[model samples]
Target: MPEKKQKKRPGGMDLDQKAYQGIRQMLFFNEILPGQKIKYQDLADKIGVSITPVIHALKRLEFKNVVSHAPNRGYFVNETSLKEITEIYDTRLLLEVSLVPEIIRHLDAESMDRLGKAFDAYREAVKEENYYNRLMTDMRFHLTIASMAQCQIQLKILQELFDTLLLKYTRNLILLGIMDSSLDEHVHIVKSLTDRDMDGLRQALSTHLDHVRNHITDGFRKMFAVKPRQMVDLFSLQ
Candidate 1:
């Protein structure tokens, strides 16, 4: 564990909310990895809270499918699932692509500025050492584009899918290797949007998403390619 100073509770938030944020930060930074057991007391100590709140926070994470609990064991960071990820990727592809038209419809100076900032953020994040920051900024790049569409329900669903992808599967992202191409892809997206080329924007979105989906699929294949007994032992730990 990194030496973290005691965290004060943020305004208007309960102990559980504070603990939740603290734990989630740790999760994002890979201070803990997928399938690793969570120590409630350790988390409570680190977050400067009581175990009660940490446990409560964990239950909420469970509802979000961010962690899993095994009988007689304890809470563990969520293990990635090929089935779940496929569903999320497919859904995200459809939602994001569909939103492109609305985004083009609403294109304006403010939206362009937001997209530029999002791209700039992703570029800087990629330059940094932290993989989590890169993932977050990348998510922001996509979400910024989608938000301009102004489709409330679809946007909410897209956010949920993004949350699942980030929190649940990110620990294993190393298996997918460096996604350095996404920066260039992002540039393509921004350019297309800026030019108001609907076809170009759709292609950019589809191509970028397909590339990521392919990487994830290959990574999962590598993970599951182990011998049958070994694969069972692997999941048994989670």
Candidate 2:
């Protein structure tokens, strides 16, 4: 019998994936802000794809809790409440603090060098005012430390938590002048790790997370304050 060749799949999947990533970046970079409604045609136009793929991409985002779809109102970005944000930060502190000891046990010269490089990249991003790159590199720096613990389950959970928290909040904080202090806090963390000062590392990590919680909560309160509605006369002429 002759060997049968496998049929090639249509390129629709590729387009769908591309659209998914495009919309995700839009969300991550705040091109589409939280609590804002979005139209499929608008997303299709922005992403340079047909409406079908945009719909599929949004469905995927909806599955990830990145967006919510309403029957008649279309899709809206998922909004994180102050209470939810506080709970997330609290959970993060517990997971990351527990991982610190494991990270210390697994640290080697190569790991330290990698951490240095990640830190350097983040600093460069900060200097260049590249908010998107800074956010990514900052995640990398922290994830690198988490990976040192060699616990896949813990790392995966932490990554998901970080993603959910960062999607809408961290960019606002960076814009509000929190990056400089965050970088300083990271420096203290790295120094503690380098010196194998376990107590110092715990304290530094706790302080850093506390600062993060404070900055984000404060920023949200100021940014999301309700404004008084302006009364408009229906028959007014300009």
Candidate 3:
């Protein structure tokens, strides 16, 4: 049977949310590449939604730095930048490392269970051989650790950072062959958590993130070297 290309909507999902997830799926599948100017009608047509919801979704994405807006230029997908992504990594390290103590302090049976399950999910997801699944499970694993800190603001910031980093650099993740080492790093993190070793936890996380950051930034250097501000349509190129 041929697989359906259309997205299935969850019950009770509003158009705005459906549009958001639809666009995100496009991004994950590489249907929407960076440096592409997103047309509201085109996005809406792809998602089977009205232009209004796509506009709202793009506005939200603009706030996350996933897209950029201009006075009359509509929205263009932001190209990857080594400098900006490196800053994101440094900022994330500062925030996540600082939250280690609180994560440890607030550790309880429920939290520990969540962390363990999240790790397990990531480990098992690797076997599924789906990039999007791996990316999402990998993200959930880290976010699970941060969620234990009980800090909503930092958690939100971290989520947005992950969103930008993972989505914008999806190409790097696919080509870097970094996921091979990620499971081992995730295991080290879980071990530190189980032992309640704050310093060790920080080390594991720092090393893991640093490795990912380095690989991605290195991979994207060539990308930025020739990156166009906006990707023009093939039809327009003529």
lDDT, candidate 1, at 164: 77
Q: Which residue segments of model 3 deviate by more than 4 Å?
A: 1-12, 177-179, 222-238
Q: Rate the local accuracy (lDDT) of all candidates.
A: 0.84, 0.78, 0.81
- Residues 22-101, candidate 2: write the lDDT tens digits: 88778776688878998888888887778878888888878868789999888898885777777877888888889888
- What tens digits encode model 3's per-residue C-alpha lDDT throughout 83-161? 8878987888788888999999999999999988888888777887766568778889889999999999999999988
Which whole-number lDDT from 0 to 100 does residue 19 have in model 2? Answer: 79
Clashing pairs in 3: none
Tens digit of per-residue lDDT, candidate 1, span 1-238: 9995554465767787899989888876668777789999899999999998899899999998989889999999877788888888888898899998899998899988998899998888878855667877888989899999989999899988887776777656644635768879888999899899999999999999999888887778888787869855754553
lDDT, residue 64, model 3: 80
- Give the top-scoring candidate (TM-score): 1
TM-score of each: 0.82, 0.80, 0.81
Best by lDDT: 1
Residue 3, candidate 3: alpha-carbon lDDT: 92
Error of 1 at 67 (Å): 1.7
